[model samples]
Target: MDLLRSLPLGLYLEQPVTWLHRLDPRVKMAWLMSILVTPILASPEWRFFLVLLLLVLTLSARVPLRVWRQQMGWLLLLSGLVLLLTMVMPDGLVVAQQPRLPSPAEISQLTEPFETLPPLPQPTGYQYVIYDRWPITITQRSLELGIRISTLLFTLIYGTNLFLLTTAPEEITAALEDVMAPLRWFKLPVTEIALTVTLALRFIPLVLEEVQNLVRSVQTRAINWKKLGFRGSAQVWLQVVERLLENLLMRAEQIAAAMAVRGFTSPDEHKVEWHRFVLRAWDWFALGLLAVFWWARLVWGGEA
Candidate 1:
């Protein structure tokens, strides 16, 4: 199993650079933040809109069908499962109410000419329970909760995935460092922080590679898992895990040594400008659209 190609989360797409890739990473970061933050306490309609918006963005960007199909297919399935589970679960809206009718003893004590009043009719056409059956009951609140949860899950994971897919690691670090420049006034090690982030991002692929290699090695050995039993399999995997950690540490040490050999002692002294930060026409247009997005959200996205 090729983990790199099969699971491409947080991995940037290098070929077929789309307009999304060309846009300033900083602007993309802002838009990503907007997509992630707008779902809080939002109406179900708004949350659904965000889900559609992310899908639209992915489609418009023309991301490879193979890439997004793997990413979104599983995510959509998970969201649907969550929605179904939530719909069947209790919504916590049940409350005890005093009966309108008096008890038999109390009724017997009533005045001589008293008669029972007619049952009152519902004033509105609203029904809280949408469906009822022997084993399953779905209420309006439960449905709303399902929609909210499913949409939020889709929005959070897919939104961040799209951002990472379009934006490169260098671009991400550059954008973050630029945005965090203000923290320098407080004597924070902004450059060092940026360097650390850059390394961390770059190290993801290495970690995946190590895992893939170890799994392939284990497969080539053709170990009889059925014969080995659970305890044997667990012990074998424990050794693999230990070796994986050692290899990762060695990789990190190699990277550190390479940097030192290249005369890179400190981040502030040996700063590497990965990408130039410049807002283009498309970026300004995106910012304008972002303003409109927020305006619409504030005006109509609140819960009923």
Candidate 2:
């Protein structure tokens, strides 16, 4: 049930009101962007450093341990799964080819291997028999590449999760709108887009809650799953999903109706009241730290 409740990634922690939660949304946005962009073209070592940096930030934010435990568990599981798959799956070099049973000539050549001649040009690629049957060659380069890719993915996702954990939907939309405000000069519908994003973010948690409600509702009925069989159980789940979608649609319509009643018909008439983002000394200090991150990325980012 707790895992189900944590389905929505965009949930904001409202209580505790940590410093990260209180940071100016626009500044937070800047920090997010800086962290997000700096990792591109970075080596595995740099990405690992970024992962550590995220850990340090998460610790400093003072968000409750329980709040992030499930997330961290999922992240670790996901990362391990990815790494395991990478290790097990051979690289592109191991493409399928017609099976090559030892030919008479090859067998004869092998049987006559008494000559300790200078090592023949290293075979184009390694081919060693595994279990004296299946042949496989593991390449160091391929393994390193896979590990690097997995680490990169884990670091990027965990950092984004940290941002979503701390920031509110309204703050996210406002920060985006503020950052993209200059685009209005080009006659872009920035306000409308931002508002649309805001509504979408606002509904994410509600949709997750609706899912939980549907699950609980089904559970409360005490359906005998052992009696229903696999097909019946799947059908029951499908019906539940169908109802959930219908409820979501109905909820969306109600919201639309309410907005219409409140005169939210036109983007021009709709005004967004932004939570004022006053830059203080801490904000500057944060920016300075970001600058240092950029400098570090530029200088030592090539080492893996």
Query: Scored by CA lDDT, what does every candidate get?
Result: 0.91, 0.79
lDDT of 2: 0.79
Q: At residue 59, what lDDT does model 1 achieve?
A: 88
Best by TM-score: 1
Model 1 lDDT per residue over 1-304, tens place: 3787777476689989999999999999999999999999889889989988988898898988988897788999999999999999999967998999778888788786358789899999899999999789999989998998899888899899999999999999989999999999999998899899999988988999999999999999999999999999999999999999999999999999999999999998889887898889999999999999999899999887
Q: How many clashes in each structure?
A: 0, 0
State the lDDT at 216 in candidate 1: 94
lDDT of 1 at 50: 94
Cα displacement (Å) at residue 284, model 1: 0.4
On the 0 to 100 scale, the lDDT of residue 254 in model 1 is: 100
Error of 2 at 162 (Å): 0.5
